[model samples]
Target chain A: MIELQHVTKVYPSSPRPALDDVSMQIDKGEFVFLIGSSGSGKSTFLRLLLKEDSPTKGVIKVNDKTLNTMSKWQVPKLRRTMGCVFQDFRLLTNKTVAENVAFALEVINKPQRTIKRVVPEVLEMVGLDGKENRLPGELSGGEQQRVAIARAFVNRPLVLLADEPTGNLDPETSQDIMLLLERINRTGTTVVMATHDYHIVDSMRRRVIELNDGILSRDQSRGVYGLGR
Target chain B: MRVNFVLSEVAAGLRRNLTMTVAMILTTGISLGLMGTGLLIANMIGDMREIYYDKIQVSIYLADGITDPQRDAIAAQLDSSPEVKDYLYESKADAYARFTQQFQEQPALIANTPQDALPESFRVELVNPQRYPVIAEQFPNGQNGVDEVRDEGDFLDRLFSLLNGARNATIAVAVVQALAALLLISNTIQLAAFNRRNETNIMRLVGASRWYTQLPFILEAALAGLIGALLAIGGLVLTKILFVDKTLAGPIKAGIIPPVDWSAIAAISPVIAAAGVGLAAVAAYVTLRLYVRL
Candidate 1:
């Protein structure tokens, strides 16, 4: 489902490369957790996965297409296969929860019939049925994050790339979101989650890929977060 | 589905920026109004031109001291000229009789004038008003047995040109004002778009087509222009009734500018409306192309 061949990234005006010679892969339906410290290049990796930015050196193959070779115009088509959740939720404040999710479909020029049917179903999945009409500001932190998640998954993409889904949530709420991610994973969709929350990482015992200073330190199936400790 | 969703989003956007929408309306109103006034003035002057131009008469006054052959030669010249429409030669006797008819109440005063002492002149009408100069050019310094040739059109020509120039200047000033309004409208729309940069960026990320994002903004700009034009038209009508015909024309009755003609006002209203709406939409679209394109 995803492959990065020694991908290296250096943002303009930066002294050092963000992702230094990183190469990795995860099969279809695999749930992968990228655990790292504050500046482990986790977000950069996810950005490359979604084709928001390209690798300075090396190739990124997502959904069987070489991202480097694709023209600027083709980037959106590639992004259609993946859902993205930011740490801030990045939901349009002016739009209601339903409209926010519906926007994902709308941008793709989805028909009214599809919008009517799909929006409600996704809102239900995010446990935001009655709250659909409410704006993002009216929602709680967890609920807003849930709406963001719903917007990502509404399109039924092949991969869900979440930078930090549970970053702002309390422990109890974070676990519920993890459970939701797990539920989504069971539906035969690839899930790549990057998080600094070691407690959930250690407790879930999912496949883990560790990166330290832009280099992959370890890769384990049934991996543990506090492996060194 | 795509259209409905975009439209709903645009509606939501417009509602979100209610104050902005009203501002646009005001801006459009000002610009369109100026344009309308300029057009009305130009059209009114045009109508005055048509009316006065049709009745323009050319006077071929006879020489003060002339013989019968000279008079007959002048009559023959009038018949030969292509510009001549219909000529009436009022002889001294005929002139005397007509003068007496004009002041018939003063019978004793009319009795003192002799018929042969009266001035005989040929009242010449032209085929077209434009040909007055053509005939005048032919009879320079009374060359064709005519002692003095006066068309009465030279004064009218100078007056028409002066009025036309003034009206044209008003239109030019109005165009400049309209341009400024268009710029303001463009700036306002740009500000509206700038305020919603995050919304637009998100739409881009979500694969929104260029049209889906731009349609609402373009429409909003056009709406502003339309509002401005309507206000201008209304103000113009009020000004025409209250000021143009009522006050200004009354004060200027002794001068060159005439009373306001309703038909001229009616002629160019659509042009004003179209200019308003078109300018507004164009302003929005031009700004969007520069600022909104991803």
Candidate 2:
């Protein structure tokens, strides 16, 4: 679960707050789409959730732990319970697909035996089974995204935060990634995705929270991306 | 954390930054080599001081044409003095014979020296060598049977001072080289971190702690330092064998200067290794804290 109450983020030397007086709640195992245009506080929202940036004046509770009050040494522990995916697919270019997925578990100090076993299973789940030895540079964009997804899911984190996971993919590949994400959400891991993909947002009927000019404009159950301010 | 995994990462990092790694190692080796040389010089100075200072003697030269009774009176005065630990009276003939024996290798010099040229004196060893002034005052110049009182300890003082200056100079240069080595280590670590920025970014994103991300880089520096220390020790051994032992063979054989032995090198090897590893690791750690985020 994630909760943000009266959250406002202001960047120094900027005239306005990035996220102004924002409040939201998402329960366990819900797939929430955060729809916003560029510079509409979507990235700032995700960064606040990840504790990468502190809220200027707000309280953020993730999994019942108040993030604003947490010490720096506890940040890594908080992050270990969550997974993150990026727009660029953020795979290590030099590592093989399997190694890339295993890297997630390795960082969490997983045993070698568990990494050896789970890496293949996650690769299989993401449909990257046969490309285990291929580097990210050698893989297609869609396949690379799958590797990134596999890496994110390898630890079975309680929450998954994706920032434009399919931003660089074609429409067809983007649909496939959405389906994969939907399947992952069904397995009881809460998923929060920030995106500007109108077509994908319109097709995937889910709980949508729309942001416009640093304000929450709409929160709808079973929503679609509407063309409205 | 698995040490094997960390070690593998360290190996990969070093391999990627091979040129920088080599540069760091050579700089560290040279620096530690100079440091070890300085330490060995200090030890050599200590040995030389013990060798020379223990044998220091003061000579009370009798004036020419002195009577036997005056000489006997001076000898009686020396016998009663507590400052004289022991005295050997060398007559002119005995002094000349000893001089000839010393210059036996130079036949021309030995042949030109006459029998009465050398002085007859009391070669007096003091109970405490530093009490030369007491002996000088007891047998003053222009006194009965006294010409001059010469203390070998004064010349030893000047000699040791020169050796101390050389030792201090070597240590000073070593300190400068050590500073250069530290800077090189810092730069090399920064470069290595920059090269592996992508990997480190992913590691940080994947729940790796800051220390976990830094471990491999630190290990790489430490390994380079370890290799550098070994090389420095080897350099010291080679110098002892090829330079000191060979060049100073005659003096060492004659016991004029102490030979730099294996025990002295053994004593300093650990200190050099510790300095190498400690300095390199500290430099890398500080660079990471200040420059690289991780």
Quantify all predictions' global Cα lDDT against the true fold.
0.78, 0.89
* B78: Cα error in model 2, Å: 3.7
Query: What is the Å distance of residue A108 in model 1 from its true position?
Result: 4.6
Q: What docking grade applies to model 2?
A: medium
For residues A13-114, write the lDDT of model 2, one tens digit per residue: 787899999999999999999988899999999989888889999999999999999998788888888888999998888789998988888877999999
Query: What is the TM-score (0 to 1) of candidate 1?
Result: 0.74
lDDT of candidate 1 over A1-229, digit per residue (tens): 7999998999898878889999888999999999899788998898788677889999989888999998866777787788887778999997899988988887878887998999999889878899989999999988998998898898898899888888999999898888888888898889999998888888988899998988998899988887666
In model 2, how large is the Cα lDDT of residue B38? Answer: 88
Candidate 2 collision pairs? none
Best-fitting candidate, scored by lDDT:
2
TM-score of each: 0.74, 0.90
DockQ of each: 0.43, 0.66
